[model samples]
Target chain A: MNRYSLNQATTKYWPLEDVVAASAKAELDWIGLWREPVQEYGVERAAKLVADAGLRVSSLCRGGFFTATDDAERRAKIEDNRRAIDEAATLGTDVLVLVSGGLPAGSRDVDGARAMVTDGLAELAPYAGERGVRLAVEPLHPMFCSDRCVVSSLGGALDLAEQFPADQVGVIVDAYHLWWDADVYRQIARAGDRICSYQVSDWIVPLPADNLLGRGMMGDGAIELRRLREACDAAGYDGPVEVEIFNQQLWDAPGQEVFDLAYQRYTEHVA
Target chain B: MNRYSLNQATTKYWPLEDVVAASAKAELDWIGLWREPVQEYGVERAAKLVADAGLRVSSLCRGGFFTATDDAERRAKIEDNRRAIDEAATLGTDVLVLVSGGLPAGSRDVDGARAMVTDGLAELAPYAGERGVRLAVEPLHPMFCSDRCVVSSLGGALDLAEQFPADQVGVIVDAYHLWWDADVYRQIARAGDRICSYQVSDWIVPLPADNLLGRGMMGDGAIELRRLREACDAAGYDGPVEVEIFNQQLWDAPGQEVFDLAYQRYTEHVA
Candidate 1:
């Protein structure tokens, strides 16, 4: 059965191991793991915990951030993504999410930044393909247009994914970021089976204080989740809806409380 | 020739007619008047005042909040637009700025809302066309997707223009709203001669307290103004560079000061 996967970032106040244990405690079917936590607890421990907790590793949190000042640093990011692909494979995660990094520092060339992403993805794709892991390029909000993901539209992601004909290249469409796009449904239809994951959240505040981070939880914001789901469904998209909120206040909440909130809101806001 | 056209909402504190006088005092070449102000002054008085002040109406503030719950109110808005068209004609302003309203109240049907806009545009285009008034559909920021403009991309605007091909159909590629689009340049190029006016302002914050209001003056935000001009130039778009900033703080200052600040920022930022 396709089940709810809480991107542990919702309960990021807790340590990675604890969050995994708590997701297990909450009986969540799957968990989306973040990088820092995996690195802190070590990949072996994270993998062991996922096995013990009976949680499917839905996706390894992130891999890309290819934009950089120099070629060597850019190459280093590619190497890191290769490692991330391996890590996702070890964790039995089918998708390795790629966050195409924002503009290289002091550079206003978005086209150049995108070129770097495509080139980096070219390097990471073969490795990820060999490891049996899908690469899901996530399109963030244009508010992150400067320092975060350069992939701001689903069309841009689709353009990038077109470079790879196989299923290894996919997109992670989040409601929080893409709920406003005029062509989101068309893009989702374009994505089809390549939509590795469907992320849900609401747009609570009109203005986000922190551009890259401040995401609202379900029901608390303006996005009508069921409508978005209807759009995805209308587009013939069937994939796991990952609850990925980056609310600072939600992160500070107790782990169980966060899980309870996510669950409660899931039914009220997301369904 | 470059002309300074003060979009009135940037200084909401001034009443309709007073803004007209102040605009003339500032030696601005043009003024973009909103509907409320004209209604407040009455169409005859509003028309006479601009004529008396020797001011040019660059564009009428707008028409088309087409997404409505009932047909009666929607028809009423169209009726109101007709009056605005008459007023624009009376004031010798041929540019009728049309912002396709946001998703209807208590609705998440963006596509339905957009269809309503295209229909509205189709209905109004012939009338405005006969009157020699070109309706410039302004594609607002993605943030306005909920309660403001549904047309969030330049491509979306171009598509509308294509759908209703007329000398009357054009676009207002406001930099603050469109600076972040991945295909902004391409879409602008596509707009070509259909590009009626180019507006400039900076996005000071991602989401201000008043999302509809609170625009940053050019140079205050991250957008590279010169680069935008270069892109527009490359696309063969040579039209009036309308300085349209909706900053509450700037509006609060004296009217002449507002123009002074706008002019100063334009020269400094666009330099």
Candidate 2:
């Protein structure tokens, strides 16, 4: 329970105020946030709201999508990422998760798209570093490689992150996205201090119509949540274990109920 | 076109007779057969049908699902695999593709399941070799790791295959599955003569309800099909490049129409 953090996405429909209050009420030490809701609630207000409730912001949801075919679109994506970095800084979170965008539309050049991600990170890492924000490169499940993130493995993320300082760029080890790899344990160990965030979610089968929302709650699917968490801990990631499920059923549940269940599962399956 | 082979699964609903006749009419040199249809039509008859049509069986569709919780069930799966080897032998194809089963139900031990795959291969490899069949271990896309296959990357498959004689065991380099990995090209190079089959299928986004049927025609999705085929060739694999798509739309189309479109796409994207 001491290391448990309820990522806002677990209860996506829950208001910022309600989530902050619930985290504090639940006596949690940290709360992970998303950029959209924090901006909507006013970054300063959201920051103060969590600070007032004595909950530290664990991380800001995202800041990448660098793959684009044209220069104009690529520049625009970089600009959007700069704003996300600023938002992460303002929210008082050191970590800003980046879901590196997929290949550009109508493009079969995966190498070119990955190169774009490398360029995006090179452009943003220094800017993020100055603001005390670590850009966490999240390797989404390979299923999302075509339309979501091009970084599809922790090793791939580390390859990109190795180019930058550990404090400026790191990797997010999300159980649901990585549990399938036979090399995961080895990669997790290699992650070491570059592990900026350790997120726990189970891999449920028969992924729903919207595969993005197919993440199951911890202990609900095939992932070895505790084993992964222990691997992170052994790798020296003494940080918040964020429960960040994106299932529609979880979203429809009462905010407090979802939060409670997440905390319970974290204790049982991840702690 | 000389290297092109159309796997029967691409037109799953098409009768075997029509498929064989269509392949012969298309002037294709090779065809890949699935176990179920070949068994349904009687293995000897299907073998004769293709042989008489001047077409060769490039490979057999499958012979795995080795992970099972119970000892009795495990033995049954091994027996089934032996029968699959015999079927492949009868069909005059050296390669028998294997989709290693996922974690057993009520199990979180992925490592244990992978071990089961290794054990299954060790037991069957000698038997397969005696019958002139090379067990081609296919590392399915990681999305299917929990349900369809635990061997989720080319490197993982290579690790399993390297344990046995190259003549007895090999790996399947399916572009649709291995295309997303950054380490894929290096792994392909490492495969060398252990490459048994090179399969091509485009990976489309917004995967359908049945994720298994989400594979797209070659030119319709993001995979760098030509690059992957070239990689296989560079790795000393002068084998047939099988177009194995599992899409609902392809299955619903007229068999010849689908075959024509696949040949055209394979010419443009994979050849």
Candidate 3:
């Protein structure tokens, strides 16, 4: 109970104020925040709201799409990432999740795209470290490799993160994105202190038309949720266990109902 | 091209006889065969039809689904695989591509499922070797790891293959599946003589309703087709470069049109 943090995206339509009020009512110690909504409600206000409600931000949703075709575009993306770092700092969260951009449009140069991700991290790690914000690289499922993130496996994410100091650049372990990997357990173990966040969501098949919203609730799909959570625990990750699902069905449901349901499922399937 | 092989699945709607006749007319030395269609056409007759057309069978479509919950079910799948190996022997092809089955219906034990695959391979390897057929383990994309094949990377497939004699068990390097893997080239190089087949198909985004048919034609997606082919060559794999695409658009197109288009793209993007 002490470690549970409901990522705002899990109940996307839930208003920021209502979510904060609900988390406080439910006596939650932490809540995950997204950049857009936090900014929309005013970052300072949102920060104050959470702090006033006796809640802390577990993590900021994301900021990394560094794969661009030219120097100017790449530099601009890096600059945007720096602002994201500032946002994380303002929110008082040490972690900012990153979904590394996919291949540059019309390019089959995957290696080149990966190099851009490495360079982006190198450029941002020091800045992030100074701000006490860890850029947590989240490896998306391989299905999203061509269009969402070139870093498609935990090992691949670690490969990029290892080039930097652990406190500065770490990785996120999202079960929805990594449950199918055979090497995932070993990678999670290898992640050790570098694992900045642990997220949980099950994977259901016959993915929806929009694959981005295909995640299932914790107990409803085939993932060994508790097993993965335990693996993260064994690897020395004692941070908030965030529930970050992106499903149309879940989003369409009533916010409080979904939040309560997710909490129950987390206890039954992941905690 | 001496190394070209037109996998029948690429032009799936074409009658097997016509695919054979067209390959003969095109002066191709090799043609890939699928199990159900060949079985429907009478295995002996199909074999004679192919041999009579002066075409050698490059490889048989599949022969694995070894993951099952009960002992009886597991044994039945193994028995079916025996029949498939016999069919491959009758067709005079030495390669029997295996798409290892996914998890048991409601099970989340991925490691247990993988162990079943390894045990299944151990049981079939000697029998397959005796029939002069090499069991070629095909690692599907991680997207298919849940409902289709659990083996999801060249390195993972090789991990299973290395447990047996190379002549008895090998791996398939399909560009559609392995192209996104960061360690793909290294795994291909490690494969060495354990490489039994190399299949090609491009990967396109916004996967269709049925992801099994999401494969794109070469040059239509972001895969580095020629680069992968060159890597296989560098790894000492001189076997047939089988063109295998499974797109609804390609299936609906005229057979000869798709066939000709595939050949052109194979030359432009893969050869």
Q: Compared with the true structure, what per-residue lDDT tens digits does model 2 show for residues B144-261?
A: 9989899999999999999999999999999989999999999999999999989988898789999999999888899888888898999999989998999988899998999999
Model 1: chain B TM-score relative to the native chain B: 0.91
Each candidate's DockQ: 0.40, 0.91, 0.82
Q: State the lDDT of candidate 2 residue by residue for A118-172, as single tens digits.
A: 9999999999999999999999999999899999999999999999999999999
Runs with alpha carbons beyond 4 Å of true place in candidate 2:
none
Give the alpha-carbon lDDT of every model. 0.79, 0.93, 0.93
Fnat values, candidates in order: 0.36, 0.88, 0.71
Tens-digit per-residue lDDT, A1-271, candidate 1:
4467888777877877777777787777788888778877889888988888988888888989989999899878988888898899889888988899887766667888889988987877887888899999999877677668878899889899889955678888889888888777788888777778888877764555564455777876657677777667666666567898887778777888888888888878766
Off by over 4 Å in 3: none
Residue by residue across A1-271, what tens digits does model 3's lDDT show? 4899999999999999988898899899999999999989998999999999999999998899999988899999999999999999999999999999999999989999999999999999999999999999999999999998999999999999999999999999999889888889999999999998899999899898889999999988889999999999999999899999999988999999999999999999988
| Pairs that clash in candidate 2 | none
Q: What docking tier does model 2 reach?
A: high
Clashing pairs in 1: A204-A221, A207-B207, B215-B246
Docking class of 1: acceptable
Runs with alpha carbons beyond 4 Å of true place in candidate 1: A15-18, A25-27, A71-76, A165-168, A211-214, A219-239, A264-271, B11-28, B37-55, B205-207, B230-237, B253-258, B264-271
